[model samples]
Every structure is written in C-alpha cells, then in structure tokens.
Target chain A: MKYVLIILALLTVLTVGFVGLRGQTSRQPPVMVFNDLVDQPKYKNQGESAFFADGRQMRLPPAGAVAWGRTPDKPDPGNLIDDADYYGLKVIPLPVDAALLQRGQRVFNTYCAVCHGGFGTGNGVATNYGMSAPANYHTDRLRQVTDGYLYQVITEGKGLMGAYGPSIKPPDRWAAVAYVRALQRAGNAKIDDVPQNLRGELEKQP
Target chain B: MHDRRLVTEGIRVSRIFPKNSRQIAAALGLGVVLFGGLITAGVTYYFTPKYTRVGYTPYQPVPYSHRIHAGQLGLDCTYCHTNVFESPHANLPSPNVCMNCHDPAKGNIKGDSPLLAPIRDAFKTGRPVDWVKVHKVPDFAYFNHQIHVNRGVSCVSCHGRVDQMVEVRHEQPLSMSWCLDCHRNPEPNLRPNELVTKLDWDSAKDWKVSPLTQNTDSQEAFARKMVKVSALHPPTNCTTCHR
Candidate 1:
C-alpha cells in the first residue's frame, strides 16, 4: 500500500512538470528581426540598397501589375461542331456544298490518296507496300455518319491514322473531310449511264 | 485493565485516521492540479495562431494597395497579375511597368508613403524592386492561379476583400481543408468562359444579356456564378493538392 502511494505521487509530479514546460514553450512570441540597410551582397555595385536614407520617394507600381501578352480572339477549333460526329457523340448535318467537295477532293488526293488510293477502294501505294489496308469509304458505316462526324475523323485522325492537326490547318482539314464524303458517294453510284462527255471514252476502252 | 485497553485503542485509531486522511488529501490535490494543467494546455493549443519559420507577415519594400487597383478602381485582377489565370506564378511587375504612369507621381504622400520609397530607390539605383510575398502557401502545395481564375473563383474568395485592405493581411486561413471546402462544393456563381477576366460585370445593371450576368447582389447570385465548367472539371484526387 505504501509503495503504491509513492509510485502514484511520482507519476503526478512528472505530469505536472510536462504541463508546465509545454505552457512555457507556447507563450514565447515568434522572433522577427529586420535586416539593416546594406548593399545586396550578391551584386556589389549594382545591388539595391536595403534601406532608403530619404523616406520621401516616388510611387511604385501597384501589386499584381505584371503586363500580359494579349491572347487573340480567334474561335477555339476544339469546340468545332465536326467533333460531335467523330466521337459518335452527336450528329450535326451540314449542307452539301460543291465548293467544299472540290476543296475536299484536292485535299484527299494530297493526304488520303497516298493510303486509301485515288479511287478510295483501299488500293493505295501504301497497301502495295504492305501497310495496313485502308478502309473502303463506300461502306454503310461511312454513309450513315453525319458530315460533321466525318470531318472530325479526318481532322483529328481515327484509329491507325494519326491526327492531321499539325500538317493541315483547320480550313484545309475541313475541306479534306468534304472530299472523303464525295469519294464515298461516287463509289456507291449506279452504272445506269455514264456522263455524256465520258461515254465516248468508255466506248473506245472496249 | 479497562483503562489500559481504552488508552491503547485510542492511540491505534488516531494513527490510522491521520495517515489515511493525509494520503487521500494529497492524491486529490495532485489529480486536480494535473487535470487543470492539461485543460489549460489543450485550450491554448487550439486557440493560438500557428507561425512558420518564413513568417506570414514579412515587411514589404512597397506598401502597394490591392484595394485601390482591384477594389475601388474596379480593375480586373488579371490586368496586372497577367499569368494568374494561366501560370503557377502571379509574377511581380517590373519597375519599368510601374514607371509607365507613376514616374510623374500622382498621389500625395501622407508623411512617408510606404510604396514610394522602394520605387524611388529602384529608379536611382537601376535595381529591380524586391517585394515581399503575402499569403504564401507551402511549397509542396501546387496551387494554380489559372485553374481558380478560369473556373470563376473570384479574387476575393482566396485573397479576401484585398481592395478594402490598406496593407494586405493574410486574411484567409489558407489551410488545406479551407481549400478543399471550395473544391468539394464550388460556389455556383462562377461565370462563363468569355467573362472570366471582367470584374466590372459584377456591378453591371444588365441581366437580360446573358444567364451568366451578375444582376442581383445576393450571396446566392455570387455562389451561382462560380460554378465549375472545365475539361478537367475540379479534381479531388490526392495528387491534385499534395503534389
């Protein structure tokens, strides 16, 4: 009983000592020392003086006054409607413009014809070189796609074809998409009658 | 025999009573003191402001006022802190930028202007002014000024009413949890893309022009305007804040 009493007394004393020490540490204010005026040691002659001898001085620019380069007000192509159909996210129909088709045809011969062939039936020079066969643009899937979606696939590049974004600017890329759609339509055309100008050439071939 | 027995019993009773009472009294006294000390210590820890080695309130070379530029003049916060909406650092303006209008000196100095001394010194010495930072977050915390600014988080949300303040105080606690609160449930008042940099829109009397307009002065209007609309959205992942 006597030993238990002594042990308890010792524990109590230790607890009190710890509490007192903690209190003392908490009360002490944080020290802040302002450095006296001296030349910035890093650059001797060119250093900014730490303190000004004359208190009267010119006004500095306000805080947060950094000038920024102006961003141009051009439309963000990322938000283009063409992206809707490409991801199978949305379908926005665009009018079939002859000018767009002509532009598209030119772009296709330059870019797509190297892989998909001029006729677009997957017999391009790339296929002859043992590259992966380009898809036949006349497939039902291609036909069903909205013009916007087709444009997105061409501009952004789908599957094996890397994005043409770096090589083709926006207007040219959109033209290329229109051309692909034209190729698909031409391939699916029925051979009921050839154009009047082309009939004579067909007869000579036979 | 009766007298001897009574004397012996009294001596035994007295010894037991005094020693036991003294022990009990001492134990109670010690327990009270210890519990009281612990309560006091806990309270102090809870209430006291935590200070860092690089103290929050470092003396600035200039006493520039955000209140004048952003608050009263109704200038866009991004007008000066150009990269605040794009870069990590809301970079300090160069002395040349200040000299654009201020070389002529517009405002009258009351006694000694805190801002003027640094500018004059920089002009005389051909040295860049070294302004001290206020509202500094820990280095480990990656806070993007662009993300917040673009997402429609008002300058006032983090910096408090800086325009109202003469000498910018570290108004917000800027604790991790304080940031998380806004991230978790962003205020609804966030504006649309085009109007992100315009603060004058807040005081505009037009609401019919767009749904994004700030017509009403209610807290709800402000909260609604801060709604998040971004590609990344508002990421709550640990690496978002920690790294």
Candidate 2:
C-alpha cells in the first residue's frame, strides 16, 4: 500500500509539471495535424504572385505583346439598355412596383444613406465628421432633374462623389432612383394628398 | 549451491530491496499506464484546432477597428463587403472604397492621420494593403457567405459579436464539429433575412410580434417558419464541404 501511494505521488508531480490550459492567446500559427489539401499550391483570389513584376496577380499586364479571346464590349443584351439610350435621357427599364421600391429602400439604406440622410435630407451621420452637405432631394435643383440624369450621376459620379457603378448593380440604381422620387413625393405631400379617411388621423397628431 | 542459509544465519542479514518488492514493481507498472493515459488526454485537449484555432489574434500590418466602424459608426456590413449577397466569397473592399471617405482632398475624415498612411499609399500606388484574413476555414472546407447571409445567418452567429471586437479574434474554433453544431440545429442562430446584417438584432425586441405576419409571440415558431419557407436543408454529407 505504501509503495502504491509513493508511485502515485511521483506520477502526479510529473504530470502537473508540463501541461498548460487551452484557449490562451497565441500569436504563433496553429500547427496543423491534418493538413490534407488545406494549403494548396495555386493562385487564389487577390493573392500575391512573385512571378509578376508588380507582385500582384490581379494587376494589368505590363505591356503584354499577345492579345487573345477579346470581344468588343458594346451594346450587350444583358444590360437591357443601349449605351445611347442609357445616356440619352431614357426611362427606367424595369417595372415600377412595390417590390422595386422595397429593394431600393434596402440598397439605399446600405450604401447611400451613409452620406445622404435616411430621409434624403442631407444630414447623415457622416456629416457629423467632415463631409459637406450631401445633395438634398427636397431642393428644387435635384427635384427638377431627369430620372436618366440622376441615374447617370450615380453610375458615373460627379465632383466629390465616387462612382457606385462597380459596387452596386444597375437594377439597384434604378430602384434607388424610384425611391428618391418616392421620398420627394412624401416630403412634399400636403393635406390634400393624404387619403380622405386618414386626413382626420393626420390632423389629430399633436 | 551450498547450505547458504546456514552460512549467513550468524551474520547480520542485509536486503538489497525492501520486503514489499513485488508490490513496488506492480505499482510501477500501474503508474506507467496511468501516466500514459494522462499524456494522451493532455495531447487530445491541448494540441487540436479546438484549442489552437480559438483566441488567435494576429497583428495586422495596418490596424482597423470593426468596433468603431461597424458598431459606433453604424456602417452596414454590406457597405464594405458588397458581394456577400451575390457571390460565394465576401470580398474585401478595394482601396478605392476606403478612399471615398479617407481621401485627403475629399471626405477628409482623419485623412491626413498617420494611421491612414497605408490606405492612402495603396490608393496612390495601386498596391493592395495586406489585410490578414482572421476567420478562415481550411481550404478544404467550402463556406459560402452568400448562402449563409441571405438565409438569415447573422455574422454574429459564427463570428461572435464582431462589432464589439476592437481587433478581430478567432472567437470560434472553425472546426468541422463546430460547423456541424450549427448545421444540425440552426434555429437559435437565425433571424429574418432582412435583419441579418444588424449584428445585435433581436426578434423579441426588434421584430413586430403579431399574428398577422405570422411573426407570432414565440420566436422559435418564426425561425422554423423561415427555415421551411427558405427550404434550408444543410447537408451533412462528406462532399458538401470537402468538395
């Protein structure tokens, strides 16, 4: 019994000497025990390439001599509007419906509402920093503009604004235009514009 | 071979070992087995990804705070990660996107600050900033941000309150068992598709609880309805993620 007790005490001391707990902050890379295809030898998206002079896999080639598989990018049927029509004060190609307005509201809240106020009043949270007054849709200058003109400005940004053409899809841009028009109408609505039944409720507000 | 017992009986007998020599040898053998088990348990606990992958906070080349940008500023996740709804990968924002607000001549919010030098340099020199990706599953496991975000899995579900994290940390293990835990039962982690980006969204407080829209008093019923409506069948088959 004494020998068994002594052996157990010695084993406990050795076991406690070298073990540390898990989930501690580790700056070192995790050692992979099963690295089956986890680290593949291939080019991934936006990966650096030592073979290129610029070390960028996504950069434009430096004066490459050969050109192949190039197609003339003009008047694609997928765009649903021609370049001339899009720039020539064309109407919105998509159907103007509740669904379009809802989509417009969502996209506007995500992208535009950061600078433009949620209500398009040019008083967003960004203005609290250093941004100048974003264009207020309530102003006569923006209210009088053509729908195509608004679309063009959004696609190809004007003076201070950056072009959203790359980030936002074209359909969402049209939806935002429709939503901007809705905000303008909602801003300017008078008592007569309200439904006859709901006018009493509007007047009842304190 | 002689009568050694008679010969040594007169002298004081000395034993090289104790009287309990058999007991000591048996105890030593048992100790070896127990010590081996302790080492095995310690290795299983401390050496796997469950321990190593969590709490990994690598120092980024240029530090950016998700807490200030996403939490305090209230910038939506999609504002920068624009392709999550459409593409499998949630793309990192190009430097031009950063320059929209950080340009020295333009929006000019801390534009000249030394902290923003890397962003401005990338914008001018056309080289990408080396932002270390923190939360990554192994290359073998395929994770689609589009499918998860659109199906009402909030970023907080897997990432664990990223808006609150000043520097990104690997909050979850990202092991296959961790992924399977959610894939097996995802009701508690789900919300409406509309509010997926709102990190702190709560159905009881944020959503309207009315039977008219079938957003009933019970939040579980609503989440189950969402699963049925979206037809979410998260596959547990081998090829689903490994492929």
Output the number of the DockQ-best candidate.
2
Q: State the lDDT of candidate 1 residue by residue for B1-243, as single tens digits.
A: 999999999999998788578878887777676667766765554333233211234456776776765565444454345446556666555554344224434211231445576776776675667765566555556787777776666666666566676666665657676777777777543555445545445533434455555444644555554442234357688899675
Q: What would the per-residue lDDT of candidate 1 be over residues A93-200, giving only the tens digit for each residue?
A: 344488767756655765667567788887765554344656778789878876667656666666655455544545566677667766776777654456777676
- What are the TM-scores, per candidate, against the unseen true structure? 0.43, 0.86
Candidate 2: misplaced stretches above 4 Å?
A1-20, A33-36, A59-85, B1-19, B203-215
True contacts kept of 1: 0.00
- How do the residues B1-243 of candidate 2 rate in per-residue lDDT, one tens digit apiece? 367776675343325566777877787787777767777877788777778788888887768898988898889998899898988888888887887777887778888989888889888887788777777787878888888888888887878888887888888888899889888988887776777888877666655643333445556877788779878778888898887
For model 1, how many clashes? 14
True contacts kept of each: 0.00, 0.49
DockQ of each: 0.02, 0.48
Candidate 2 CAPRI assessment class: acceptable
Task: Give one digit per residue, the lDDT tens place, for model 2 in A1-206.
Answer: 56655776676566555434467676666777667677676676677778876566775533433334433444243355533356556567789999999999998998888888899998888888888878788988888888888888777776667777667788898999889889999998888899898787788876
